[model samples]
Target: MTSAYPNGDSARDSQDVSQPKQSLFPDAIAIPPEVLARHRALVLDPATAARTKRGNRPISTVYRADSMLIPLREVQSLVPRPGQVSRSEINNELAKIGLQLRPRPEQEVIDGAPPELGVSVPLVRLEDAPADRAPDPWTALVALRDAFGDRVKHFGLDHLVLSASVAVEGAPVSHGGMVGGTPVSHGGSVGGGTVALHTGSRNPVALLMPQPPRPAKVPAGRRPVVAVLDTGIGPHPWWSKHRPGDPIIEVSQEFQDLLAAQEGQQQNPTELGPLNHPEDVPNEIQPLLGLIDSHAGHGTFVAGLVHQMCPAAKILSLRVLHTDGFSTEGSLLLALHWLAKRVESGDPDEMVDIVSLSLGFYPETTDPEKVLQVKAAIERLTSLGVLVVAAAGNDATTRPFMPAAFGHGTGSAASGVELLSGVGARNAPGHTTAAFSNWGEWISRWAPGDALVSTVPVWDGAALGGIRYPDGGGLGPWMRSAPDPDDLRSGFAVWAGTSFATPVVSGLLAQALAEDTTAKTDMVGRAKRALIATDAELARRYWQ
Candidate 1:
């Protein structure tokens, strides 16, 4: 296959001299000139530009699978080693090079843990110092890592992770729709306010019904909880039966607080910002208009899939990604740390058995320890018996997507742990690997992900893609019209990605745990013992 990065750099095995065969799928689809211009226009809009700023830095909304984004002048590092190097000593060393650290107290401290999970500090480049042009935050980070070497293993770029969805032409970023290069979805005309999938010539019909009642026989504590760290859940008919005060689908206050801390006082509480894709705006690219964000109902769809396979499981919804399917590595790390804390709390009501992460990003460096902060957060959860399930991404490459790819390595936390499961996507009919699904030895399992039906928000778009006919001499609501592709009043949608597939495995794991007759108190221990068999059973049932 061609190099995953546009610049022809591979994230893994860079030293391999063997020629790589070309795959039929393209890494990126060619964006039409018109669509490209539309994206440029949106970027220049004042309202849109205002939303992209994280403090004084403007976050990049575009998706480049090969590259990772960190705050422009910031670097993340673990707490300094006491004897080897103190924080003050490190700052003093940086000062010699015309740089200093501005520690982030919020990100550095986890409520239950020491004030040392990891710290993202601003890297101020001194004007009078050696270098001519200011080095990008990533460049500065590499210098620091090289200087410290093995003494500091947990420091590097804080990647801006994205949903494992297909990138489309004219759209700001990939959210499981349209096609730029790798054709993940066939016959779908997306990004111009059209439906994401083209099942036929008609619009998708949502299933207008309430979700089936939950099985009441199983006690609340026995129901395994799967935490979905994606877009926040939206209003949907499927969840109507859930009782009041029940957190069947709710936001994670802990994660929200951490994110607020990261963004500082400029954070917008009502809207998830500094990490979202634009949806409300109409540009030349999305002319049909009134389209919801590409990945608006992502969390709802994922929650629906889990409920379908395992109704008894309680889903803990954590809003990490914006409706547009963009998230920061800092936010993801915070979410993971929160999950670890929940598992360690030993409170059955607060524990999560399976964590479904439907998003990931590729790191520029191949060394596993360089991205130690992310790997360590995931390891902490696994050590506490929480099962981590991550999407293998939709880039259709073997390049290691972090957190998911971490499942393949060996280290202090992963040496003998069997808790991490990396999942790839498959089609439901033939049960074969989807063409767009990332695959390799690192991927632990596969499941049906393409064209799968699930619940979505009960919202309608103003896009008038189909023919419309007015009633009563053009003075009333339209009596007849062609199907509106963006109209999701049906409260259901068909989406494809490893993002969807990861949840299938998570739901199945929860199902297995709920069905187990073993002691429920030690949920962590129970999950650890069942994970290996669960992995094998999933392979036998889905991959055989």
Candidate 2:
């Protein structure tokens, strides 16, 4: 077994130190009282609590695994320290169960103060037994707790985190049947009398559209850069034309692996013969435009919004979320670390003016250590003058969402973070908040996210999953289709969620930073001030 202590000290040896006594569950920790009460209740009746929690949620959404972060001291007290417990031993002890343990990296110290817990053990799910054996998750958790008692510091679902956006809505409206030998859709109007071509098709065999002109240029070195941490960017024409050079600076290998795994799972044996090559098919007909999954194009859409709002701002695409739009807390933390590294690199161009995070997680417990880690990461980034923006979530509940809710406190770093809530489009204004958007005082800003039209991976034939179109029937319109004329830019789609709202705020902030010369060095403070001004202005215009 590997030593739990960084100094190579065994768990027992580390416990014999003459230092001051420390409680595994410390008073300074910030686990919400309600969370603790619920945990206690759960431990008392695992089966009932588990069943109740899983009753309404679809099985697809419910995570079958429970991940626990155990402190080293607590582990030392266990009958068999987690590090000392082998896979076979655990499986044998708890029938039809599996456990895998890995040591967590040391927690970051804040303000020159060391963290309460020096080392943590991450207990992850390896696999599950047959359903007839017993209900999973709860059964597995109960068995581990029975064996380890209080040694299990914090237990929660290894939630499958995803973008806070809801499904796409409304059918795209097309203009005259053809314009200059091309099928074009009239997208209302942009500046003055100019009609926006929402959708355009060239040859009947080749559904090509004309690309929009390049955005107006800004003064060199004056453009604010926004880093998008989401799914990977694209091979779309718009992105390809705008970002001629290397656009995506970083792509997470873990996310790529997950994407490949999803693609492998999505492979249809009937559609493609046993030996058919995927590359032979046209790009437009492929699902997700041959990307990993439906949500793989999410980052591109978000970047498009930012570009549309702040044409002068540069974009840095950092792929963190998997193709399915899911990522774990550890993955997020690593991404933040990467961001911090880039900012500290001393290259002015690499320094991100703002970070747009459209993703979040809802942990069953508010484990103080985990919360503090996230807070520390945010503080580290903000302290370096990078503004962070996040979605308020689509849960449609008052339950607080992290990173977003972290933006709300009195802490110095909190001011640098902004939380965006979702609102209906200006044309379809009725409800102050979108029905699916999470709301409360924690949300710092609101932006139009309902029925938002943005870029999507180009595809033809039918949208993935053969989802129904808003026109009351038939297959959904593809953002990109086969025989696509290379003359036009990529496709677009109408989606809704607080996820999109976050990027709106991010783009607005980037625009503010680009236009204000004096605010460049202190963009965080500038962004907060701008947010306050906008809030007041919005209230005066709408609330009045």
TM-score of model 1 vs. true structure: 0.74
lDDT of 2 by residue, 318-427 (tens): 66654444555544654566677677787975677788888875544432234554556677777777778888776555455666766653222244344222221111
In model 2, the runs with Cα more than 4 Å from the true position are 1-100, 103-157, 167-220, 243-296, 366-370, 409-431, 461-490, 519-523, 533-544
lDDT of 1 by residue, 343-408 (tens): 788786787888999998766443444566777788788877788989978766766676787774
Model 1 segments beyond 4 Å from truth? 1-87, 105-108, 114-116, 127-135, 168-204, 208-210, 219-221, 244-247, 265-290, 367-369, 408-417, 471-477, 521-525, 536-540
Task: Give the number of the best model, judged by lDDT.
Answer: 1
Clashing pairs in 1: 1-21, 28-181, 29-180, 29-181
Q: Model 2 reaches what TM-score against the true structure?
A: 0.57
The 0-to-1 C-alpha lDDT of every candidate, in the order given, reads 0.60, 0.48
